[model samples]
Every structure is written in C-alpha cells, then in structure tokens.
Target: MEIKAIITGCTGMVGEGVLHECLQHPDVKEILVINRKPCGITHPKLKEIIHNNFYDLLPVATQLHGYNAGYFCLGVSSVGMKEDAYAHVTYDLTMEVANTLAALNPEMTFCYVSGSGTDSTGRGRSMWARVKGKTENGLLKLPFRAVFMFRPAYMHPTKGMQHTQKYYKTLSWMYPFFRKFFPQYVSTLAELGQAMINVTIYGYPKKVLEVKDIVAAAAITGK
Candidate 1:
C-alpha cells in the first residue's frame, strides 16, 4: 500500500529522521507535516503547513483529509516538569490533535512515538511514564483503523542529519555499547521510521510495539 502520511514534530530529532526515511522510500508517496515553524527540508512528495496551535486544528482541518496514516512524533521532556503541566502538553495536546484526526480520517492508522517503560496502567511511579501511558490508552479508545504505540528506549539518530539534537551527541557515542550490551533498548532512527511505515502498510499483531518488535518490522516485504 502506498503511504500518504501526516507527520508531526518534524523539526525534532525523531520526527526529522522519520521524515527523511519517508522521503527516501518508494512506498511513501506523499507526506504532510504540520509544524510550528519550517522544518527546512523539501521534496516533491513533501508539503508542509505551519501552525502554532496543535490544540486547535480546526483552522487546518480541511488540509488533513485523504491521509491514510499519522506519525505522531511530537514530544517534550518531563525533567523538572510538574504533573499538570506535563499532562497538558503530553496528554491533552496530543489528544486534541488525535481526536480531530481520528474523526476526519477514520481509516487512518496512527503511530505514536512513545518511549520505553511507559506505564499502561497509569499508576507507574514515574510521572512521565504515567502521562505517556494515559496518552497511549486514550489513543487506543479513538475510532481509527488502528493505533500503534511505539516504545523505543534510546534511538541513534541518522548520522550527519542536520537536525540531530545536540544532547544526542552524548547518547550517540553510547549507541554502540547499548546495541551490543543491551540490544533491546537500542534501535537506530532509521529502523524506527521503517518499522512505523511497515506496520501501517501491512499491519502488525500488537497494538504496542517495543524495541525488538520495531527492529523486526524494519525489513520491507515484496508482498
């Protein structure tokens, strides 16, 4: 199946990496990104819409039609963040956009880039994990074709990508060690993107995918 996907958070590391893969692949025929600012990349298959308010997508709802998939890569750090503030950005904001999309495109398969150790029960000790868990559960309740939650531990961003975040320099160096010692926790950005595309196109058994499952889906199938 040809993928015409709407990608969020393209200005960030994970989203940028995923957008790069989508542009390079043959199966992903089109991409639309809604960003607060320009993502600074271009392709014939790509079109971008700049909008600051993710909470209110009604203004751009017309442009969101005809897409078969959504890659929700937008996220913020919870360090030193309070519960209410974190929930507003992480949970409420995500739901605002997701609810609109699910209604507009009922057939759209939504893939969310959540981190590993996310709490499914919403009772985890970690604040961030609990919030992420709530977001995952909320999306599952949406009336879309499917909602696949991706729980990657640590990602090695694509080498030389201009948007690769500064903090990742520290993590990039540890990628090799993590891959060797803790293979399940380490996955490349490229694999994460491919796995998302594969799951949306052909579908997967699990609603929530971990690092190993993400790696396994990276391989493209002819049939």
Candidate 2:
C-alpha cells in the first residue's frame, strides 16, 4: 500500500531522521510535515506547514486530513522542570495534537516517540515517566487503527543530519561499544526511522516497541 503520512517535529533529530527515511522509501507516496519552524527540506513527496500553535489545531486541522499515518516525534526535555510544567508539554500538548489527528484520520497508524525507561503505569516515581506513561495510556484509548509507542534509548543519529543534539555527538563514540555489549539499549536513527515506517505498513505483535523490537522491525525492509 502507498503511505501518506503526517509528520510532526521535523525540526528535531528524531523527526528529521524519520522524514529522511520516508523521502527515500518508495512506498511513502506523500508526506506532510507540520513544524513550528522550517525544517529546510524539500522533496516531491513532501509538503511542509509552518504553524506556531499546537494547542489549537482549528487553524490547520483541515490540511491534516487524509493521511493514513502519523509520526508524532515532537517532545521536550524535563531537565529542571516541575511536574506540572513537564506534563503540560509532554502529556497535554501531545494528547491535543493526537486527539485532533485521531478525529481527522481514524485509520491513521500513529507512532509516538517515547523514551526507553518510560513507565506505562502512570504511577511511576519519576515525573517525566509518569507524564509519558499517562500520555501513552491515553493514546491507546483513541480510535486510531493502530498506535505504536517507540521507546528508544541512546539513538545513534543518522549521518549528515544537521538537527542532531550536541550531546549525542559527544556520546556517539560509545555507540559501537553499546551495540556490542548492551545492544538492547541502543539503535541507530536509521533503524528507528525504518522501524516506524515498517510497523505502519506491516503491523507488529506488540503495541509498545523497545529498542530490540525496533532493530528487528527496521531490518524487515532491508533498505
């Protein structure tokens, strides 16, 4: 089947990586990326919408319709942030956009970029984990055809992507070591991107995919 996707957070590392993979994949026929700022990419299969407000989707919700897949990679760090503030962006903001997309595209296979240590119980001691847990649980309740929660740890950034975080570069030298010793905790950005695309097309046994599952899923296409 041809894939038409709505991607968010293209200005960030994860989103950019997924967008790059989608542009290269033959099955991906159309892509609509909604970002707060320009992602500075152009392709025949890609369309970009620059919108500042995610809280209210009334403005651009119409443009969001008809997509069969949603790659929701937008997220914020919780460093020095209070629980309520982190929840506002992590849980509240994500749910708002997700709900809008669910209403617009009921058959959409939604992929959410969650962290490795996320707590699905929503009662975890960590603030960020709890918020993410709530968000994940909430998304499962929505009426989308399929919703996959991706929990990747120490993602090795794809080469030549400019939006990579500075700290990832510093820690990249450890990726090979991690891949050999603790493989389950690491996956490449390419694998992460391919995993999302593959799961959308071929479905998976589990709804929540950890690093190991991500690697296995990515290998399916062999691109």
Candidate 3:
C-alpha cells in the first residue's frame, strides 16, 4: 500500500527529519505538510498548506482527505509555563488536530512523537510528562486504524538539517557514549523517522514505543 501522509511540525527538527525520510522512501507516494509558516521546501511529492490557526482547521478540511497516515510532531516545551497553559498546547492542540484527521481519514495510521519518561498513568509529578501522557491517552481513543506513541529520550540530529536545536552542537558529542552506556535512552533522528514510517506501513506489537523499540522498528525492512 502506498503512503499518503499528512505530516505536522515540519518546521521543527523531528518533523523535518521524518519528512526528509518520506521524500526519499519508495513507499511514501505523497506528503502534505500543514504549518503556520513556510518550511521552505519544494518537491513534487510534497504539498504544503500554510494555515495560521491549528485549533480551527475547518478552512482546510476539504483538502486533507484521502491520506492514510498522520505524523503528529507538533509540540511545545513546558518550561516556565503553568500546568493549564502547557496542557492547552500539548494536549488540547494535539487532540484537536488528531480528531480532525481521524474524522477526515478514518483509515489513517497516526504516529505521535512523545518522549521518554512519559507517564502513561497521567498522574506523574513532571508537568510535561503528565500532559504528554494525557495527549497519548487521548490519541489512543481516536477512531483511527492504528495509533503509536514514540518516546525517544535523546535523538542525535541528522547531519545537514537546518532545524537542529542550537544546544546539539555542545551535547551531540556525547551521543556515542550514551549509545554505548544508556542505549535505551538514545537514538538518531534518522532512526526515529524511519521507525515512524515503518510502523505506519507494518504494524508493531506495542502501541507505545520507547527508544529501544524505535531502534528495533527502524531496522524493519520494507522489501
């Protein structure tokens, strides 16, 4: 089955990486990216829609049909923000978009980029984890063909990508050490992207995937 995917957060690092992989992969036939601003990319397989408001996607609902995959990579850091404020974006915004996709494409396979240490119980002390858990829980309840939550702790940025975080320059050198020592907590951005794509095409045994699971999924051959 060919993949016609709607990818969110392309202007960000994770989304951009996933988009890059989809562009090169043979099974991904089409990609639609919705962003508040231009991601500055152009390709025959890519269609970009610049919509300022994610909360209300009614304006572009007509154009979002027929896709079979949804990669929800949009998110925000909870630093210095109150619980309610963080949850508004982390949980509310995500659910709104996921619901929109679930309605438009009932057969869509949704992949969400959560993080390591996410509290599935929703009662964790970390505010961000709690909000993410709520988001994951909410997504699983959506009426889609499948849903997978990816929890990656530290992802080494793909070389030559423009959206890499500024701090990676200082910390990226530690990736080898982490990969050898704390293997469960570290993976490359390429692995995360490939894992999402692979899981969309070939289902995994679990709904929630951690760094090790992501690594294992990335190695799954599509051939």
- Each prediction's whole-model lDDT (CA): 0.93, 0.93, 0.94
- Which runs in model 2 stand beyond 4 Å of their true positions? none
**Which of the two candidates, 1 or 2, achieves a greater TM-score against the reference?**
2
Q: Which pairs of residues collide in model 1?
A: none
TM-score to native of every candidate shown: 0.97, 0.97, 0.98
In lDDT terms, how accurate is model 3? 0.94
Give Cα distance to truth, residue 164, candidate 3, Å.
0.3
Clashes of each: 0, 0, 0
* Candidate 2: clashing pairs of residues: none
Ranking by TM-score: 3, 2, 1
Runs in model 3 with CA error above 4 Å? none
Residue-wise C-alpha lDDT for candidate 3, range 1-223, written one tens digit per residue:
7999999999999999999999988999999999999999999999999999999999999999999999999988888999999999889999999999999999999999999999989888998998999999999999999999999988999988989988775789998998999998999999998998899999899999999999999999957
Q: Write the per-residue lDDT of candidate 2 for residues 5-95, one digit (tens) a residue.
A: 9999999999999999999989999999999999999889999999998999989988998999999999998999999999999889999
